[model samples]
Target: ARKGVAKSEQYEIRREEEEMRSQMSCHSLKKRAVLTTDSGNCTAEEASESEAENSSMDEGDDEEGSHEESEVEVLDEKGFRRTQEKKISNVKQTELKAVEDEEDDDVENLLKEEEEFEEKIDFSADTAGALKWKEDLTQKAAQVFLRQQQSTPNLRKLIYGTVVEDEDRE
Candidate 1:
């Protein structure tokens, strides 16, 4: 009795495995059929079926077309022209908006550059202020040299021995 029960269990497992294998083979066959259809390898019957589906869909579109025709009749020529003009104006407005945005960006960039330049100038001014005495030293020396030359009054005479000037004085 124990051996018979074990055999029954094994038989049941084998049956389940066979069922799973059949399901997998069916799934793979369906996938291959889809692949072949998508690759444009469908039969004439499949193509005709797809055409029939498309024709049924187009019949629905025909009802929508009648609604559009009714709406067109409701819109007079003047109203249609006004709508066209509104569309043109909207396009122009969008173009102008884009230009204004670009100009705003350019102005922002310029402002940023100006601020950077001002910062650099401020920094340079601070360093230049610290070195101000060096520039003043040369000017101060030049002034002192000029003052000594003016007070002495005879630099050319000392250097050249004052030939014509001393004779004139004598």
Candidate 2:
């Protein structure tokens, strides 16, 4: 009795495993069939999708056409000569907008660079201030040099320009 019960349980488990394997294989085959099937030329869904894509593509062209038509109507009311003037100003507006954006970018960059340079200058000045003796000595040396150059005519001439003889001076 015990052996028979064990055998039945093993058989039930094997059957269930086989059923699951077959169900998976069937599902995979159905998926393969759907992918491989070709119903013929374009279906209604495909045609609709293609039409939607084309309509979207044409939308930009339609916008351009409408703008041109409006311009033509306006020009008809204004006159032909005015059309040329309007076009010239229209073109200038686009060009000027681009130029203004470029100038804004350039100005922004210039201001950033100026801020960075000021930071470096401030840092160097702070460091120089921290060294009181060194800063004073440098200043004194520059002043002494300037005075010596000013007091000596020969030295001043050599430092500045050619020494004028009396005729050249006149």
State each candidate's clash count: 0, 0
**What is the C-alpha local distance difference test score of candidate 2?**
0.42
lDDT by residue for model 2 over 72-139, one digit each (tens)?
A: 63336546446434533433333344445555455444434543344344334333432333334434
Best by lDDT: 1
lDDT of each: 0.44, 0.42
Clashing pairs in 1: none
Q: Give the TM-score of candidate 1.
A: 0.25
Per-residue alpha-carbon lDDT of candidate 1 for residues 53-84, written as tens digits (9 for 90 to 100):
33333344433433343234234544644533
Off by over 4 Å in 2: 38-170
Off by over 4 Å in 1: 41-170
